[model samples]
Target: MSVPAHPRVTDVIETPVAAPARPRHRADIEGLRAVAAVLIAVYHIWFGTVSGGVDVFLLLTGFLITGSLVRAMERDGRIAFGAFWTKLVKRLFPAGAVVLGAVLVMTYLFFPRSQWMTVIDDVRAAVLYYGNWHLAAGSVDYMADNSAASAAQHFWSLAVQGQFYLLWPVLITLAGLVAVRLGVRVRRVAFAAVGIVFVVSLAYSLWITAVEPVWAYFDTGARLWELALGGMLALVVHRVDLPGTLRMIAGWLGLAGLVSCGLVIGDSLPYPGFASLWPTVAALLVILAGAGEAANGRFSANRLLGVRPLTWLGGHAYTLFLWHWPVLIVYLELTERVRPSLTGGLMVLASSFAAALFTTRVIEGSVNRVTKRHRAPSWSLAAGVIFIVPVLAAGSLWAHSIDQDRRLRLELSSNPLAYPGAAVHLNPELAAGLPDLPIHPDTTTVARETIDQTRSCNAVVEDTEVVSCEFGDPGSDYTIAMVGSSHVRHWFQAMRTLADQHGWRLVTMTKNACQFSSEEQVYRGEVYTECTAWNADVMLELAELTPDAVFTLASLTDRKEDEHVPTGFVDRWRLLDGMGVDVIAIRDTPRFDFPVPECIDRNGRDECSSPKAESMAEVPPFKDLPNVPHNTRFLDLTDSLCEDGVCHGVIGNQLVYYDTDHLSYAFSRSLAVVMEPQLLEAVGQAVPKGEPTLVDAAMTLHESAHS
Candidate 1:
């Protein structure tokens, strides 16, 4: 392919050029590197409290490296793929290995055995370059209901970059080769191809951000354009030159933009799409300002950046990146807190810096020197394979183990309320009279009185198809509706038993994370957009049915510790009251403060075998002071579950909680003895004086169908 002549000289030689006069190392570029590094650290430590600054770093990386790669390819007829791979390894692996090794050792010492298994899994993923996908699948949920996973969660970004690095060079090479075959200038073709990919990827990123923001943020498909922006810069390098004043302006503007991106773009922005352009564009401007004859300018090439400390940091940036996150994670894990104190943060930072320096000096320098001396492509390839293979194997094994453990737990903890044996054992009082009560052959008929009352009182009914008023046996007179988030849904097994025994049709309206609130536009997926519109529509249906009582549970973890009532609970109470439906606020059970799987894996069945009394004593009862003026009654089973101020792990020989916060179906069903009276009191009803009938038996069921 014909190459265009430009004023800038190509710096390549047929043979190794004497490492060309090491141009005065520009302080500004180092400063910019320092800035990128700092932004990432701050964002993760505090602002992951809010936005993803790491994505900005990715964009900056892509722009800088892509520009360098394209310039190299344009200057030389071909890119030395072997050399490129070697440089990448030298840049990334030494520091990465140190971090991974440290995490593994620390994880063994401090983390529970169950968490160790996850560490093994993550390490494997980290090595194999698929950590992002693993994390995405895990979701590492940080919502009120779900807590964040591993401190190593930040490694997911590194994995994304690794994957990109693996594929990008190949893509660039293919594009170059294709351009050479055709009658196009290699630089122009490379530039055009990168530009096209950037636009397409950016478009895809936007679309995916709207539809599947979580995946979009993690997926390479959505992130490639950020890197392409840099490649585009490399191709057009010789054509554009900024004068001194403009260079200064661009440098300042770029720095400002980068900082602003972190400050302004909070967690609310669907990340790594158009919004990411702010940081990326800013990065590009800085890179451009540092290019050409003006590369030695004051702003970018200043002495501040050239100082020993900044230069040392810039040189070890890759190492520092690897070491920082795990240190932060380990610190948080030991403390069991999200926001570390300033002193703690500083300690973590100091430790990470120390580790980075040691790893770079001892490990990275040695590896680079050894690899450069060997210069054997076969050895490099073999080493790469060796490094990656165990990671892949370990990841697969860990994934399998996790799946197996989940299945085993599920099997052992299957909903006991659904088991006939458990039901018989759970309520001997009800079971004793079950044989004497005559079973009604049919009870499908809806009472006319109930139908009339529902139609007159129900205000939110939008569809007749879902809202049905049906009569039970002539003796049956009650109705019940189940409502709330996924946790409420977990109670369906018990709800079904109660509904069937009482001869009342069950009306269920539930959505995951959708608190049954009147407020619209809760955040969903990746964006702060409206929740599933159908959820609101379903609530309207439930309101129309106007059941005798609405049953739902307040999430224990969802409540801020200082606040006794969950925010969702407050919102939901108002909506239910407005609908004129009586509310049964089932108090949430306690969650194990630590990771459940870690405890289980380490302790085996004994991990979950604690008596309910012992468990309840450790976790205090929620003091529910009603915030609403409506007819709400507080139910307290804390005293019943806890004897002598201590809650037992097992209640009636069944595990009280299956995982951390969720009540075991068997345990929940057993609670019928303690709960039945409170339920009656809450509904302002008296229990029949005679032997318990099917209607009375129905009141005893307390298992959850939704979690």
Candidate 2:
């Protein structure tokens, strides 16, 4: 490996394989760190934006650590991975633990019971790492953007960096060993190997971001190129002895690039792709500029970055990053404000700085100082203690929540009064049995019965093709096709009993958060291509199978009836009408910002009911949007679902909602009494007169095909 004459902080750790390199005390790099932290905090708090600050951090992580690994391998013919990791734990863990412990306390005091389980899970993921994967899976879910932001979401990057820290050493060790076997210089082999990773990973980033941008955002595989770019630079930067004037100009431009990041590159774009190169490369320029003394001269921007205030901020940058996000998200949720006012933003910034300064100085710096003076085992033991305490506390919280939820579910099944799912509709006498407050079978268990969580034939977000699930009586040839998204899927439970009793087959095709629309819908700021593709296939299949009638959602949630129909609803209605097929368009269930069931669980029934008129369209959307008048029938079960111009959270002793919008399976099934009659009336009215009813027509076609 080619060696740098100058020693640096990353190089100075006394691992067994480490050379006796002294600390370089690079002021410019520290200054860059300060700038990065400020930009990220400013964007997160006030701008409500992404500024590519995480991109810079990824680059710096690879740049700083790779130099030391190379030096260690050269000095001892191998890297001492254990000592290297121990040094990182000492530098990173204490501040993170202090902030997480504080977040837990604040969460208990300020957050609602509805959000408790969410934050607890995030806290655990934050402590253990894998928060990024947890978040990626959630980000595209039907319920993803509906909830408030998680306080610990930024731990995703920290998790990514931690993963990189573990994996990089192994990769570098292998590269070094292979190079030795091949008689090639270790630096040449390492750079080439990392460069290959950079190209392949960048291509994967582009593809995944294009297809599924939400997952791409936090995916470690998609982000590998940014860190690999830094590794490649570490291999080549020492050889770049640029002219003093050119180096000075380059440093100034780099600083300008970093400052302009948010403005030049929009926050909406999927990142860690080609656009990320701008920030990573800009950070590289500054790192490279100050590689020697000439780039830190009066003319260079490195001199400005090396100023006292920035250096001080840079010194505590890690802690600041840890403290700022939770501080901002918790403050936003508690205040019930979307973003802060000018004064509030200042308070948030001041609060973050105060927390960061304390955690870093009292806990982190002290741990680093003590660990430096002590042996690796002492620091390792201390790190374990720091991490374990929070985990035990978080685990206890989770355990209690689980036990409580299970009790609630048990009460639902065992107690007749508590578990009167659909009885309010069956016997008017039992209507008096429904309790008005404090329902059992809490929101979490009810939420599990949602189509998304149950993972029945309901296709999840990742599905790209039609997955048809059959319900109802198989003995009947009278099939009804249910299409669109989860909004339509919730109707399954209501219609399942009706279909079997009526001797109709129900074929359902649904996807998560992806309603059928002729105009492409957006997911994570990109075209929901999978949705477009799946909808196309479903439309094609339904056209061929021309069932008795198609049942689907007829209105968008939270919009006036006349304003819109789903973008493609009209087109599909026309096609089906052309095939002499009818559509039973169900006016969608009402939506709420607060889940009524969870609200009832935490608050009383009186406080939890949503207004009837405001929750759904003032009129059915398809009523105003043109559709096949004779062939399309509109079903509004809203009356049975609501009463007294108000919607009850629990109807017929069934929790109305699993989450904010979707119907609980129990509640929807209960609606079958109210639904089946209206379903018959609407669908019967839509079938063209003189045409054989679907049952007669289907049987004739089958008999003829067999004959």
Candidate 3:
């Protein structure tokens, strides 16, 4: 792949491997830092967008630190790992601790007890540098559901960078030692190391972009390359000499590119993949332009960067980065709105800046100044650990507390729609009770056999059960498969009921967010490896069985436009349609208008009922456009599920949904009545009419389940 060419400036200066003792400051570098901070703030504030700006910062961080470390190593003939770790601890920990502590305090005050657990868990994950994994597991259908606004969500990036720092120095030192042993210069080894990591990271980026874009966005595996690019630039900085005029052009263009990246990239882009090169390359240009003899020049360096306001803001950028996101998230949670109007946006921005300034001056500044001047290396390290450890412990304890509370509440609350005389029926009693129903003897017997077979399907896959089920009969003639992501699994209870009534053998081959398409990878983290393999095995297995019918909720094709997931519903339909098997595509239900967990916590269970027609009255039409292709028959229950242009709370007096989006078992069972005609039509087969006995049997089963 070609590195997109940009205009270059030239100036030549040769210096020894060791940097001078004097502290070197460049106006352009500070300007670049200001540029980066502004771009990210603008992107988050107005766009709520994901761009490569974060990656750009990672690269700049790598370049600056690596350049300093290499020069220090050359002077001393050995790197002081202890001193390096101490400086990093002092630079990062104080601001991070203050912001985290503040966010926790705010969370305790405004957030509901129900939400506190997840917040606590997120805090713990952030502290442990594993927030990315926590997020990746929940990545599927992420757009449809709103997240509880949390300040700590943004810390995942900071954690990623911190993790990189933790490991990179050791690797660099090892490479340096090997280079000396082999008679290769340290600079050359550094260059090679950067190049190797960059190539591997890029390859990983492309693979994840195709398979698991969400994981690719967060995973350190695919992101290290951006930092490596900066490290490589640091190693070669002394070797390149650009002329004055070219240097000036490069500096301005670099600034222009940085600004453009913020403005032009929308929320829909596949981030941190190829798109990230924009900001990373721009930062590199700015760094290169400021290098060499004329480090402070008219075009390459400017008095504007050194102006009091810019420099002051630049000095507090760390605190600002920490403070801004949580404040915005918390404010949104309290207000119940996210997209602020002009005035609201300004308020958020101003408040964020004020908090950032306060935290920086009052907490971070004092700690850093005192630590740097007087603290020993071991003491500084201990202080950093002490500050971070409490937040992690608190977060973990909070998560556990929330889980216990929810379980207790659920146990105490009466089932809102539980019928007056309904009793839990065991399998043998249910089988015995079937004889009193008015139905054909043949159909009844078949239904009973199907019910017995499905008992094994629902059996929890323990060690022994797994082995037994592995070789269980992959039944033919009556096989019905349920396939898709976890969203589809939400409907399984209803489907299982119908399968029992119809005497159909049901099989489930589902993954959390994976589509049934033959794509290589889906989702993020190590889970994608398992999800992809599972999907492939399921598809191949299904092909062998050639089941009677395969059912799944309609594909969320709109996410394709945003590059959120690879395969669309139309693609999946086409693949199944070509296989000479019947495919049933069920339309997805409406998501709650507000964030579910937060709304439930705030308003109590009364306000947490199934979405009714009145609740969705204001939602725009065309938001749920039926975009599936003509080859597939789209099954929409919107009318049956809603009434008077608003979906009602019930199907025949049983609540229609389990949560905000999933259909309740009772409701799905009732849906067989509304769905029977369309299902018969799609199957292109007719119920054998004898004495109306089968219809009576089906209706009786449906009513029993719903009642």
lDDT values, one for every candidate: 0.58, 0.74, 0.60
List the RMSD of every prediction in angstroms: 11.4, 8.2, 12.0
Question: For each predicted model, how many residue pairs clash, with residues at least 3 apart or on different chains?
Answer: 36, 1, 10
lDDT of 1 at 335: 80
Candidate order, lDDT descending: 2, 3, 1
- Compare the candidates by lDDT and give the number of the best one: 2
- For residues 359-418, could you state the per-residue lDDT of candidate 1 as single tens digits? 878876776676777877655554455545554564466557655654554464453433
Model 1, stretches more than 4 Å misplaced? Answer: 1-31, 46-56, 68-91, 112-120, 141-149, 206-216, 259-261, 264-270, 273-275, 298-303, 388-483, 492-509, 516-532, 536-660, 664-707
Structural similarity to truth (TM-score) of each candidate:
0.66, 0.85, 0.70
In the range 1-707, model 2's lDDT, one tens digit per residue, is: 98978953234423233343443667888899889998888877777766778899888888778777877666766777678887777676667777777777777777665566666777778777788898887763311331267777788888889899998888888777776677666677778888998889899999997677778888999998888988888777766767898788789888899888877875646565667878888998888888754558887888888999999999888888988888887778767787888898888888999988998778876776777688766576576467657665875777597667767665665544445554354444556645554454455456654544336676777788888878778767677988888889888887786786577888888888888667688865657888888988887888777788898877676624423566577677777788887888888777676767647755766677777667665666666665345677888877766767777777655677777777887777666766765787866634446644433433353345336
The whole-model C-alpha lDDT of candidate 1 against the native structure comes to: 0.58
* Poorest lDDT segment (10 consecutive residues) of candidate 3: 459-468
**Which has the higher TM-score value, candidate number 1 or candidate number 3?**
3
